[model samples]
Target: KNEGSYTIGKVELEIKLVNRGHVSGNVKGGNFFKASGFADMFGNASKDYQPQTLIETPILAENLKPGESRRFRVVFDYPPYFKGVTQFTRIFAH
Candidate 1:
């Protein structure tokens, strides 16, 4: 929840994986959403201005007003059928 008096700045999504090829997912920011940009963990670290996200629809939200909260949904599939494969997943909102 946005507990401040002023609106929050832009929002970004980040997905990280330690050992894996690639994973796909979906994210939606309700109705009042605007996809400003998308980036992978590496792209974000390297400060690359490119859309390399795995989110199916990386719909970024508009101004997150004060004391207002928005809903988001994330759906992803498990790693392929394998054995002894570890996948470290992390999702962050910036």
Candidate 2:
């Protein structure tokens, strides 16, 4: 049937913000909190693009032990192009 559909050929403004003053890095002593990775801004989406959980930041870590080095700040509200995947493909093909 070939019922596959997706069209967003291009939308690469390439926006990246790194306040990597310290996401975490101390080595041996321990404190490598750059867990996995994440920083948003992308929507050439085809289906399902779940987004919820706006903001929350609070990491005391019982007065951080080991080699200390922590500074956190994350901001997000992506959409400089693809207008949120073309407004959901114009409301799913009207």
Candidate 3:
């Protein structure tokens, strides 16, 4: 999200290493507007039923300026299901 008045461009995000689960694939991000609905970086509209606009990484949003925010979704894949103490993992983004 670009809260500043200047336009933000070439934005990149790096996820810190995880001790438990692992990142499944590249991060996905998109923008949602009431007029146009959810759309990916490529400007492809999401399905009406699904309404998911998250796309693979390498997203460039030079147009994101003040009051404009982008949404990102990350998925962590685990080895398998386990019936033991609940495990926790902390994710840090930069």
lDDT per model, in order? 0.44, 0.28, 0.39
lDDT of 1 at 3: 68
TM-score of every prediction relative to native: 0.40, 0.17, 0.33
Candidate 3: pairs in clash: none
- Residue-wise lDDT of candidate 1 within 1-94, one digit each (tens)? 6767887665445443222222223323342223354534345566433332233334355588888887776555434422122333433344
Give stretches of model 3 more than 4 Å off: 20-62, 78-94
Misplaced by over 4 Å in model 2 are: 1-9, 23-33, 37-94
Superposing every Cα of model 2 onto the true structure, what RMSD results? Answer: 23.4
Better of 2 and 3 by TM-score: 3
* Model 1 poorest 10 in a row by lDDT: 17-26
Between prediction 1 and prediction 2, the one with superior lDDT is: 1
Clashing pairs in 1: none
In model 2, state the lDDT of residue 87: 11
Ranking by TM-score: 1, 3, 2
Clashing pairs in 2: none
